[model samples]
Target: MRSPTARTAPPTRTPLATGWGTRVLVVLAAGGVAVLVLPLVALLAATPWRDLPALVADPAVLQALRLSLLTAGSATLVALVLGVPLAWLLARDDLRGAWLLRALVTVPLVLPPVVGGVALLLLLGRRGLLGSSLDAWFGLTVPFTSVAVVLAQVFVALPFLVLSVEGALRGADRRRALVAQTLGASPAYVLRRVTLPAVAPGVAAGAALCFTRALGEFGATVTFAGSFPGTTRTMPLAVYLAMDSAPEQAVAMSVLLLGLSVAVLVVMRGRWVGGLPGARPPRSGQDAR
Candidate 1:
């Protein structure tokens, strides 16, 4: 037994690289996160807690909150209905101009919200080319209305939804989808029963992002919708209106916005991790769907 043990080789240990580059990257990442967190910390520290309750309870504040929730929710719904299909197409189809289409979709993300509002006005205002006929035939004026707010929010929010869903669809195993089809599932059935379930987490994350974007939308909402109290005014508009009259109220609203943003980030982070890169495949032979 001693001879056999002596003849056996020793166990090997793996070495990890701990170079200066790695240290620099780690320090930079930590600094980046700290920079992002400092502003929220300051906002909370500066908040006048004694007046926050009354400030938030103001009728105007309530109206803005309600309108913000309504319009943001509606815009998210619109994004979901339209974006899912667009995402699916971009992910699965072999269209010739797919790259160009994707680029166009993200244009609103880079364009200033105010510019988006002006573009909306030029296309949909009462005197606009289409708007003239729309007003003449149906007496519909989209601008300066709650509808305008929803449109502007939708325009800005749709890209987030599409990109998220498209990413999910692309990461999915299409070969598994083909196997499902060979097992007698129609394309629609496969999509509804297979693909949808696999990518649902991404969809949820996307909807959360769209809602957050819509909730914070300001320039387009103000420029196109005109910030009428109890109608077009949302939280951002309320904050702006409060800036001149009640700085404390504005700060409170900003804090609330910040809180909502944090909540969305938390929820989305959980869903995104559980869904995509960190997600494990189904343990059994059955597919994820």
Candidate 2:
């Protein structure tokens, strides 16, 4: 020991761990969190606890709740069916005009909900564009109907699914898929057996996000579908309508929506960041060990 001793390197400090950096970062982060959380806190404080049960039990509330669940579920289903393939295509680096396509897919994320509704209406309304032909030939009128609610939800929620899946596909390891292809396996077989399993977590996360987004859809649904109870009145629309007449009911419905959203986020924690505990994909060189 006296003859030879190895020297060890000192630990390095992260940028935010030095001097006043940590304190400043903490203060700013706290402010941002407070901005986001205080409204929910106030909502809880203003909720009429005693009347909550009665408010939720109202027929109109029940109808809106049921319709919201149905349309959101349907929209999620549609997104899974349509968005997944688009995501797969988008993930390919070789695809032409991918940037343009991705921008179009994400347009709804930034576009005003009411504007999206107007666009949908122009395309599907009884007298506009293809709507004229649809109505004249098939006797179908889409606007101000429950079908319109589902369509509106789909327009907004589909992007979430597509983006989530595309990210997952891009990050997934492709060696296994390539190896399968080299082993006389068909591309379809490799995709079904090797590719999809690696990205299942992404697909599930996308579906959950899609469902939640659809559940909260409001402006587009209201503008294009019109809020008719038991037909197109989703929970958000119900809350808006109740605000003018019965604020207590509106608060109660809001609390319910808040609870559902929180539950979904809790269940999906760590998924969007990486993967669930037992579901995380192996890191590079991990398989060799």
- What lDDT would candidate 1 get against the real structure? 0.87
Best by lDDT: 2
Residue by residue across 172-279, what tens digits does model 2's lDDT show?
889999888888999778878888789887888888899999999998998999988789989999999889999889999999999888888788865654532234
Candidate 1, residues 1-289: lDDT per residue as tens digits?
4875575454345665699998899899999999998887888998989998998888888889999999999999999999999999888676789999999999999999999999999888989878888999999999999999999999999998898888888887788789999999999999998998989888887888889999999998888899899889999999998999999999999988888877887968757654543455554433333
- In candidate 2, stretches whose alpha carbon ends up further than 4 angstroms from where it belongs are 1-16, 270-289
After superposing all C-alphas onto the true structure, candidate 1 shows an RMSD in angstroms of: 5.7
Candidate 1 residue 118 C-alpha distance from true site, Å: 0.7
Work out the TM-score per prediction. Answer: 0.86, 0.89
Instruction: State in Å the error of residue 79, model 1.
Output: 0.4
